[model samples]
Target: MALPPVLELVAPHDARPPQEHPCATGVLPIRRISVSIVSLVLLALAAGFGGGLLGAWMRATPPAAESTPPAAVEDTQTRIRAAVDRVLPNIVLIVAETATGQSLGSGVVVSQSGNIATAAHVIRGATRIEVVLANGDRRPARLVGEDSPFSDVAVLAVAPQGLRQVAFGASAALRPGDIVLAIGADRGLYGAGGAATMGIISATDRILPRSGVNLEDLLQIDAAINSGDSGGALVNLSGEFVGMITSVIRDEGSERSAVVGVGFAQSSDSLRPVVAELIRAGRYPRPRIGIERPDEQHVEITADVANQRRLPVPNGALIVAPAPNSPAVRAGIVAGDIVLGVNGAKVDFDFPMVNLLKRLPRGSRVDLAVLRGGRTLTVSMTAEDQ
Candidate 1:
């Protein structure tokens, strides 16, 4: 018996044998198959091109975004460095010798005439003052004038030769977050040179009570204030002097603690007038009310007396004693009277009578609202220079 017809599989490209009889008349559709294969090849090529283009676009786009930030950072750093360099020469290390000891501080040259601005407390009670320049030149300095009791500012005079003056900037234009540089001899007492620390203006128009006087219109900063940094220059990014380093507040618990980023600078706007006056005269002209409170205890006693008398305002600047034949006596403000206000502005703990008198010009007429014997009386008076 003949074996059953065996089935054989053939590749698509392989030719079929002519001896085949059944269904050989039907030819394979080669053209359609070739067209489908061509279409698939083109599609694969298009997909490859699209993927390469997407990769190139992604690489190019991210590079620009990544590079821009670093470039800006570098530019800013360069600017700050340049600013520090430009202003460094104007900064001087001050040494004051008194009967007590030698004290080191910092100052900024403000004029070609060898005028230097520094904190008054630095040179307080100084018998002989010397200024060490950036190039290590030591020059003798004389006390020109000072406003230490009220503003803690001072001016010194030296030889005009070999001094670089700093450009002054308006402190009123400064806002919070403005970049500032503090340049001083942080360790100058130990013979270190001038160093710079960077920070931003944390606040403006701040008032701080210091040594029985209120430091008003202060620029609060977050910069580090070292031991010898008082009387140093606080400059803007443009290398212009904006403020003078006055004091630093430290944390106190059991003993003295190192508090970082809490410092105060006297604004240049406030200093300008004081410095001008100091330069013109030997001291800042202060307006006087010719009455004394002596201390806080005395003020409190006067307030208590006012309350007992049922005065309209129970708290104010209480006069412990009035000067004989002075403005207070002329205005009929006796020792028992309490000054309530001046020129419609209330005088209290925040706005004290002393601060008001300081702001008033000499010979300026002011209305003092006084409380006496349970009555509110307004008295007109003229401020006298003290």
Candidate 2:
């Protein structure tokens, strides 16, 4: 039998048929072989490039440092040191000897002509006064003028020639949180090489009440102020004097207790005009109303007395008595009348009648709102010099 007819092997459907080459028998063309070699090289290159990219993406990066540069820290220290150097020369230690004992304080040179600004209480009732300069030279000082009755400021005269005076900055430009340096003698122990305490202003336009005194519009700060630090300089970062350290608030729990970081300063803006007047005329020209209210109790009586008299409001400046031939008498203000305002501004504990009059010019004509016999009336008066 044909026995499966010699069982011819069949090629699969997907198999490619072999073609005859045009070149010499059994050898491929040179162009086709070159293309095949180039294709293989390209495939190898692509694979190598992909593997290298993947490896680079999986690698970890180094972290950055968080330390500050040493040079920047040093620059800040240099600036603060420069500011202290510029103002240290103007500070002075004041010593006043009275009949009872000696008092110590601090002061700042305000003029090249030997004018100095200090606290009035420092030189009060002094038989002799001395000032020690930054170079340890002690000089005799004399009271030029003082405004202790109303303000705690005072001016003194010394014999310093060609002395460096402090550069004053505008206190009106100061705000809460402004950095300040309080420079003063340490309990008058150190010479003019005073100590410095730094702090920020806690409040502005603060009113501090004292027995028989009114400290209005004060600058409150947290600087360390000792007893001798009164009248010391409160300076800005630019080496300009902005305020005068007046007093430190002690803890009221006990008379012997001390409180740290609570002090007050008088604004230099208010001191400038007073110092100028003291230098020129030996006294500050303040307006007076010629009415006396000795204490807070007397001032507070306006409220009670107004209720008894059935007045419009209870809070005002109650007149105890008007001086004979004074401005209050000339304006028809009697003891029974109450001053409600000055120049349309209300009279309160902050802006008391005396404080309002002190702000007016000596020859200013002020309109006062008075409550008399349950009627609010306007009274005009001219301010007089104190």
Candidate 3:
């Protein structure tokens, strides 16, 4: 075998009388160095070309898709738009002249037969009523009936043809974080026609106070419901009406602001039966109970034991006194019993008895469970309509 390749550095020096060199007989060859240098250059060129090919391959490849599917995003958008379109035509702008000037609100078309549902406050003491259609047609409207002080819904009759009516949804099944579409006039700022806003259900079963009545079963939404958006449709993704946008939270941020988006609606569940009653009788039926509470959710009690007078129980709506002609007194219910439950359900403090009365049918007897001292007693009483 040939010797391994040698690496050598040459040095220049003054030449002494040169000794006879046997290396001349073994002189180094230049061809070997040239071949080595050429091999190294070729190796570098091949490595450079390989690196360039790898970079090109990476650049040509496509990027991976987003984690969220495109179809899901599109579907949500489609549903939201469709819900708005279906409810917008049914949303009517209610204009009334208050003591100040013009007041604005929203209303939903409940009858293609020309009846519209709105907040009672919108038409309170109004001399003229106008129904503005989504097609820009304004027609004269008349207040046929209203359920005030107990409910805020009012029915208006108009002569316009082809008015669309919104389909109602079950408000009892509504849960928080559900998407809802709100459609109404931006106080007519979006022109004579209506505008639509999209949001989610923020809360439910809320109690709100109206000027004329106590509104119950309120729905909280993030939709931009304004002063003029009252009586408008709060529709779900299925395009079914759920509630009416009655009021917006202002100071407490319950109303929609640029910073906080909060809106409240009177649930259609509370208004539907009332509206039907108003339409039929010109007044909504009020359910009556014998007990009165100083505060909501608590019942008052006072009792006598074996001809001995007992102390009065405070902090509850007492059954101490019953109506002279009331159902409780007629059903043989005695004073001094604390009402804890109605119809087998616990009573709430705020409008507790009122809620049970509304739900129970007239002339139907409900079992009221009472707490007397440490024992519980169930009293059966026939409920009455007021």
Candidate 4:
């Protein structure tokens, strides 16, 4: 079987944590992040240390009536500095110990009551998980829950120590040219503290295939996301987190896995509801249609794919198998069947099969337009609960 596109996460192959060493144990004085000169002035202004330059600063500033906000008073460079400082304390390194090896990644604290969000793959097969805060504080984390495999999000819990949480911003309002920061742990091999790099939101609404499912509605950036940067924060200029750094699309032509200014993050707009459900009920009740898409099947039915596969339509989800005794199996959605629509709506790249299923209300009858042997059949079935 052919493999999917290389959307690589912080895997054990690229970097592995020590077998017995706990995260951030006895690490003295982590390296300081280098700040731009503009940022230093912004920091000084915030700390009231710029009082001596008050005349110069006020002369350079616009009238309060015309200013947008505090962020508007400063330039992008200085605002980025202040934003990085505001969120730096919330970034943490995560260590997930599995039977074979360990997965090392970064995480962002989402609540002062100790709710942390990280990449689902970071803790997928973890037997034990530990989090090291940016201040060199180590805390044991308990897996609260995870979003469905279609979205790469997971939540963890720790003792409530008044941790500063990153504020969630509206990712829907972001544009392609907006400035964003990718915050992660340091690269000293120990992976203890926080660091960040600058970039712009290159694009949005991207999709990447992983395992047998597709991670949809992703935010694409040209940020320098690297190994150990998984589950890190992708924050906007105002220090509000808009997405979570998840994976990097590597250069296929290179001999080694190389990041070529392409990275992907799960948008906060899509994951906010999932996070709420997880925190409320310990899990997100993702609609279970029990679909088993054939490995490496293209989500979109292109013109060439339509002609090559000899399908009547151009786009739909191709299901190769339905799980035994599940709703799909009971509904007669069999192998070699292509899902054309759900609830009288077309299923295509814009509104994918997963998105369709996710929109279906639980306990409501789901009418699926199944393409079997080139004949369309409306199969009615209720989706299963979590």
| TM-score for each of the candidates | 0.67, 0.65, 0.58, 0.66
lDDT of 2 by residue, 35-88 (tens): 989999998999899888877866754456767788977875676677788888
What's the lDDT for all of these models? 0.81, 0.80, 0.72, 0.81
Clashing pairs in 4: none
Model 2: how far residue 119 lies from native, Å: 1.7
Per-model tally of clashing residue pairs: 0, 0, 17, 0
**Alpha-carbon RMSD of each model:** 17.1, 21.1, 16.8, 20.8
Residue 287 in candidate 3, Cα distance off native in Å: 4.4
lDDT (Cα, tens digit) per residue for candidate 3, span 1-386: 35568775654476476687545757546886689889999999999999899899888988877687889989989998888878888877777765667777777889777888898878887878787777778888888787654566889888758888889898888899898888877678768778888888888998774321246889999887666887888888989998988777665553433445468888878778877776677666655555532233223322332124444333223466676767677766666666767777765444354455567766777787776776788878666554
Q: Which ten residues in a row have the lowest lDDT in candidate 1?
A: 292-301
Q: How close is candidate 3 to the true structure, as a TM-score?
A: 0.58
Q: What is the Å distance of residue 206 in model 2 from its true position?
A: 2.9
Kindly give the stretch of ten consecutive residues in candidate 2 with the minimal lDDT sum: 292-301
Model 2, residue 370: C-alpha shift (Å): 8.6
Looking at model 2, how many pairs of residues clash? 0
Top TM-score prediction, candidate number? 1
Worst 10 residues of 3 by lDDT: 298-307
For model 4, residues 48-138, the per-residue Cα lDDT tens digits are 8657578788899877775467666567779899999988888888989999999988888887779989899889889999988887788
